[model samples]
Target: MRRHARERPEAVALRFLADGEDVVTEWSYRQLIQRVSSISRRLAEAGARGERVILLYDSGPEYIAAFMGVLQAGGIAVPTYPPMGQRPLSRLIGIIQDAAPRFVLSTARTRDTQARRVAELSGHGALEWVASDELPTRESYEDVPVVQDQPLAMLQYTSGSTGSPKGVMVTHANLLSNCETIARWLGPSEGRRGGMWLPLFHDMGLLGGVMQPLYSGFPLLFMDPMYFIQRPVRWLRAISKHRLTLSGAPNFAYELCATQIPDDELQGLDLSCWSEAFCGAEPVRSETMQRFAARFAPYGFRAEALSPCYGLAEATLLVAGKPAGTRLRTFVSPRQEDGGEASPEAPRELVSSGRVVHAHRVRIIDPDTLAECPPGKVGEVWVHGPSVAMGYWGREEESRQTFQATLPDGPAGYLRTGDLGLLHEGELFISGRRKNVIIIAGRNHHAEDVEQTAEAAHAQVRKGGVAAFPVTAGNEERLVLLVELKPDGRRTEAEVAAVREGIIQAVVAAHGVRPHDIFFGSVGAISRTTSGKLQRQTTRQAYLGGVLPALKVAP
Candidate 1:
């Protein structure tokens, strides 16, 4: 950013589209630097240097300026989304408790309301608050100190898909390494304007959406994530309107675009300018990508532009991604027979998340044996690279276990990703999560596969809202599906029975296993993390505790 400001002071560095189309606010390279420097000076005066400062704001330019300002002031930035009405305040309270920040940076519009809410909920009202937008801009002539090894830059909290969100200690070195890897993978595409609608609080948004553009010396256009949810075509239209060469989201976003968006609204949509549509933050489904590409192909969308990648907050952001204009790779795993043997009759397609980025090294290790798995075998995905974070904040034991893992004879420094995948022909194919895999009849099945199958079986079963888990029956483990239904008129018992039968038959035909039970739930019944990743464990607990709101149950 500093280099960009020095070389191209007048070039537009950032643009915020409040309506997801028209630009409401923008910042040039020089203006951005000046704002960041001024905010840094104010924060330093507030005794924020070497302390943890929380950043709370909606997605916009002010949040970006405050983020850079915290880094300039030598403060660890903790970025989190503002709590909305009826949305659980527990997440914010939990983060506040875990982070224990010295100060909070928010907009004047939300500081007082949020401060009162936090004090009422968590009883932590003594923390200082600064409205970043209210800070006066001042010229800064002070030279930044040159440090070979910089300290912690930020704490990226996990989305808590499996457990409580932990703060990933990201250092300046980690940030730079990930940014460089992303830039190198994207290469030098001409007219490389970028756009994003993902939340700035998430790693995908922070690294890919915010830092990557500045690092690559390209202008970025962004909007609130809600705009995309309210109307996904706005994202495509933004890319078309701005001629953005890079942008992407999780797998479900593509699915939503294909299903929710009407054909009439996409009459003149031109996606030819979208060069790299990277997908990550969740399992990338081959069916979803294919459907999306086919649906938008007439609008100048290319199938090869879909770059399926994989990474986590612990690795800063991206760990692997296909180069632009490369062909998508997928692997077919044979279905397991009744006796737990591979059967070639039924094959499950898995999309490859490209190859490791830059100089990073990846290894597939058996979780129990602590030994490397052979090629083509699914195991825990472990990564060792410069982009990997130092460790989790205030969690020495967990950090050592998760980030300092090692094989039997291999050197240390591997991060145990707790994700199941295999390396096939230099591409990584993710299978499922380590703890979310369901075992029934001595065969291991990915929960997502079952959930996807169930979702496709019935039209009423909501897409991306099903959770398949294993429950202990009398003498064996059985498959239980918690399904969320789409909004529709009241259904009779006959209708419910038909839906349950359809899901059961589909699961049996696809995976050769019948669902032990099926619970039909209303919309929003399934629990999801902040970033929309399904919390299967949490859903399972709700079911076991008899608290899951089920309109109908089939056994």
Candidate 2:
């Protein structure tokens, strides 16, 4: 970074729009290097190198600089999303307890607005808040960077499927290795301008979006995620206007563009410059890929540019990605992957996520026997490489269980992804998470499969707003389904009851087991992590606690 600043002092490294202003805040390489120097000084004054430092800033250049500063200062950066909406205090308390950081860096605006929430979380400790912008810049600055004695760099908390968040202990070497691997896969297109709206707290947003550009020497543009949520078309417009060569989001974001963006609203939009539309951080639905490609086809969005990727935070954000400038291959058949057998069922298209990146090896293994599966057979996905984190912080046994798994015939121990998938023609295809499999009458059923059936049963129910989990009923584990209804008030109560009926009948017909309980709720009732992935365990906790504001409950 210092080298870049010295070489191209005026070059824009990152750009973000100011609040309510048409003007943008530019962080030139020179200015960014200076800000980083100031941040390092503040950290040096407060504590030692290996201590944890939390970041709770709004989207801007300062946040990005502070994150780099943490690395430069030799502190482990824990990037956290600012709390919003109801029960914001409770939202951060768990993370606070888990992180146990000595200092939190934030802006004055965030401190003043969220004082109460901060106080509540810090009541259990003596945590300090360091003002990032108020820190003084040194009069004389040399490009001599801070020396690192420890291997640890950052602690990326995982989005847990069945429990509270676990901090993945990431080292400095891990970040560099993973960034280089991702840079190779994403490629350095002719004009390497990157633009994305994914939240900074997400691994994709931070590691892939922020770090990749810096590693690859590309200019990046960031927009407030809330802005994109308010208007999805702005994402494309940003790419179109900026002539961005790369940008991406989850599968749901693509589905939103296809369904919500009307024809007239897409006037004068051109997406031809977007050569790499890397989609990951969640399940990449084939229907979503097809819809988005078809919707933007007239605007010069090539079918070959529709890239679907597969990764996890445990692997430092990227495991495998489709190579650039190639079309994806998919299979449409009524087959349940990971089960090792074909079944008569509803057919769905499964898109190939291409190959694993440089130096990273991926294996599909039988979970029980720890044996590798063949090219076309489904099994658990295991990752082995330098990009994998050391282990989870403060949880030795838990970390060992998840991060240290061995294959019976393989030499290298692999990081068990806990995700189910298959390798066909050397390409990866994810099936689902292992913990999310719902068993009914001794038959294995993926929760995603059941949720898809429920979402397709009624037009009133919002897609991607359904969660399927199991709850103990009598002596057996019975399925519990939660569906989010559309926000429109036109759907009557009787109509809602009929929708519930339709959902139950559809699940029974498809999965061969009826849900013991069904709950209908408003749009935001379904819980999600900061990265926008489904928090099924939290939703189950809410359901069991009777806190779910259900419009109607049926048994």
Candidate 3:
């Protein structure tokens, strides 16, 4: 950042959009550095150096400036979402309790309200509050000296899609290594512009959206995640308006734009300038990408722009991704893995998440046998690279188990990603989460595959809102599905019967397993993590507890 300030002081470092069209605020390199320095001085004066500081801010330049400020003041930054009304506040309180930060940074507009809400739930009233947006800036400012010895730069909390959120210890070295690898993967950035609506608190949002652009020496424009969710077309509109070369989101975002946006709203949409439509943070479905590309192809969108990638917070945002404008690699495998009737004609198709980044090693290993799986075999994905984080914070036993695992005869220090995938021709193809795999009748089945088929079976079923899991009933495990229906009036018994029959028939036909039961509810019935990943485990627990808001249940 200092280098950029010295070299390109007048260049725009960041821009924020209120409506995703009109620019609300923008910061030059010089201005950003000055704001960062000012915040750093205030933090340092308040004895924040060498302490953990929690940052809670809406999307804007204040969040970026405060993040750099925390690093400049030699403090470890812990970024988490700002709590909103009626939303799950437990995640935020859980992160705060786990990180144990000394100070909380936010704009004056949100500081008091958030602090009050957090204190009521967290009981951490001693945490100091710093209004970063209200800090006074000087005309000419010098960078504050940061401690060079502290290896931990930030604590990136996991999204907790399956369990409790754990803080992944990210070092300055991890940030630099991943950022450089991303820059290389994206190729030259000359004349490139970046845009995003992902939450700044998430790893994909902070590292991929913010750090990558900064490392590549390009300007970025962004808006609140809620703003984009309210109207996803705004994301594409911003890209077209600014002629952005790089922008992307998870598969759900693409699905939303493809299905929700009207033709009139896309009258003048042009996406030719969108070169890198990177997708990650959740499963990337080929169907979603294909629909999005075909829907907007007439408006200059290219199929080659759909880049599917894979990574987790433990690996510091990016593990493997394809270069822009490359042909997507896909693989075909048997739909049923456990010796069911094999159909050569209807094999399941999977998309590759490109190759492992330069200088990184990826291996698929059978979790139970502790042996490496041969190429094209599904197993747990293990990653070893500089981009891998130190470990989970304050959980030495788990950290050692997850971050220090060694192969029987292979290398040590490989991160056990807990994700299942395979390598075909040097490209990684994710299958599903190791814990989320449902086994029934001695056959292995991925929950996502079942959910996808079930969701597609009925038009009334909400896409990306189905959860498939196993429940132990009597002496055997039975497959069960919790589905979310589209928002409509109350359904009659016949309509409910039709929805249930569609799901059972589709899932059985596709995967050769009949759902023991199907539960239907309204939209938002399925729980999601902070990054919008479906929480199957949470949903299952809710089902078992009889707390799920089911409009109808089919036996």
| 225-315 per-residue lDDT for model 3 (tens digits) | 8788788889989998889989988776888888889999998888999988998877666777778889999999998988999888899
Inter-residue clash pairs, candidate 1: none
TM-score per model over all chains: 0.79, 0.79, 0.79
In model 3, the runs with Cα more than 4 Å from the true position are: 161-163, 335-346, 436-555
lDDT of 2: 0.78
lDDT values for all models: 0.81, 0.78, 0.81
Quote the positional error of residue 38 for candidate 1 in Å. 1.5
**What local lDDT does model 2 show for residue 542?**
81
**CA error at residue 251 for candidate 1, angstroms:** 0.7
lDDT of 2 by residue, 207-326 (tens): 998988887778999888878878888898888888888889887688778888878878999999988898887667777788888999999998788788988777887899898689
Please state every model's RMSD to the true fold in angstroms.
9.8, 10.0, 9.9
- Range of the 10 consecutive residues with the lowest summed lDDT in candidate 2: 337-346
Candidate 1 residue spans exceeding 4 A from truth: 86-88, 140-150, 161-163, 335-346, 436-555
Sliding window of 10 residues with minimal summed lDDT for model 1: 336-345
- Model 3: pairs clashing at backbone N, Cα or C within 3 Å: none
